[model samples]
Target: MCAHYESPRDKALLKKHFAINLPSELAKRDVWPGYQSTFIRRHENADVGDDAVPPREALLGSFGLIPHWSKDDKIARHTYNARSETVAEKPSFRDAWQRAQHCIIPAQAIFEPDWRSGKAVPTRITLANGEPMGLAGLWARWRSPAGETVHSFTMLTINADEHPFMRNFHKPQDEKRSVVILPPDLYDDWLQAGPGESGVFLRAWAADELQAL
Candidate 1:
């Protein structure tokens, strides 16, 4: 479910790779669902017309998704991940997906549980080349009861039963699944993709690209 991850890279690296400023508060070693983290998305500026390019910006948002119609924040705990197969139809993610509110979550590594030992053991997974990677996500904007706007996001996941590496985690009896980690070249395309075309990029990442630590 990708409940936790590390984003310890420096701001300079984030800017160099994603071309956006990293918020000071998000410059931390670890990020968890329901916590404020950095995400990259396109935003329309008032001065720019619809025909102009929407500026790509890195902004702070909670890791779990909060639908625009959500009455409270309690639902966030279970909406941190949206299954790719059902994301377009799921109540929690349907609106964001239909509206094309896509985003990229930059991270150095992700933590998961290894159940081979009979007891769950925490394991860290990172790129085989030790580089940062981007997880495909959906973002939402909700108006709080206090009239403040709250932004949140959720990672997109897919069945990974056939994956060589990803299938090793989680409970043995549970369906194996993994989050979609986009390649560097697809970052811009994913962020700009329409709802109909977004499915093309939701497959599992190559097993060779990851290393368990």
Candidate 2:
């Protein structure tokens, strides 16, 4: 699970890459579960008609996902990552997947542990080209008893036991896995994807395009 990652602080790069204007300045940090972060997705308001232009927007949201029907926020700690193989069948992610509530979680880098030395050594991973990585995710909106609305999301991950670079992380005895990082060209497609077409983008990213520090 990718529990920590560095959110990009360069607003210019975010505008240039995602083509959306941010409502406020975002601070840079090694984001963890329960932390507020930025994400890009199509506007959910019905007022924004389907035929209207410029349907996508960037918004601030919590890192962990909370299903609309969840009784409390504690479930978020375990819902931060939804396994690709069972996302559509899992109770926490099934509704979001079925409704096509897709999103892109931009990151400057992601932190992982290297256990080769018999002890965990922290390492940061980023794109070899130095561009921001857009991780595939699913967003949800939960209404609290007090009528407050909470927005949260979960990163989608797939088994990577055979991947050259991703397979290097995690315990040697545990199943290797990696988050789905979408290419630049696929950002819009992913956000607008239907339930039937979303599965096509859930594969492992190219290893040669990434660098681990």
Candidate 3:
């Protein structure tokens, strides 16, 4: 599960890559579970008659997904990553998954623990081409006790025990997992996919296309 990562600082890169315009500055460079960041989702007017609205829109939201039933924001720390296999049944993720509230988290890179050297060392992973990554995620809207609407998101992960590269992370006894990094061409398709079609896009990314340092 990805708990920490670098959100793309260059708005132009986000615009050029994700094709969404952020009206305000990003919340942070480094993002943790409850930290504020940006996510791209299909615009509500995307399929409507509003030609003025873009197909995609970027919004600032918490890194972790906060379910509607959550009483407070603390749930974020534990819901940062949703396991793909159990996402549909997990109370914290099922609603978002069933609703197909898909989103793309724009990240410069993701960090993982490299434990092969006996001690844990943080390793940075990025695309081989050095462009920003579009991490697959689910978003949800929660209404706080104060009547404020809060938006949060969680990255979707897949088991990586058999993956040639991702299997290298985490402890030997622990289950190896990796966040799903979607290909650029499928960005729109993923956002538009319904509950049934969403499952097909949850597979692990190609190892050769990534670089770990």
Task: Give the best candidate by TM-score.
Answer: 3
Better of 2 and 3 by TM-score: 3
Q: Model 2: which residue pairs collide?
A: none
Q: Candidate 3 has which clashing residue pairs, if any?
A: none
Runs of candidate 3 with Cα error greater than 4 angstroms are: none
TM-score of each: 0.93, 0.94, 0.98
Tens digit of per-residue lDDT, candidate 2, span 1-213: 799999998889989988877858584577888888898898766246666556678888789899999887778778889999999999999999999999999999998887878888888999999999999999999987788898889999999999999988888898988999998898888998999999999988889999998
Q: Which segments of model 1 are wrong by more than 4 Å? A: 46-54
Leading candidate by lDDT: 3
Query: How does residue 135 of candidate 2 score in lDDT?
Result: 96
Question: How accurate locally, in lDDT, is each candidate?
Answer: 0.86, 0.88, 0.93
Off by over 4 Å in 2: 25-28, 45-53
Q: Write the per-residue lDDT of candidate 1 for residues 14-114, one digit (tens) a residue.
A: 88878776676764678877888888887646237764554577778888999989998777888989999899899999999998999999989999898
Candidate 3's displacement at residue 79, Å, is 0.2
Q: For candidate 3, give the lDDT.
A: 0.93
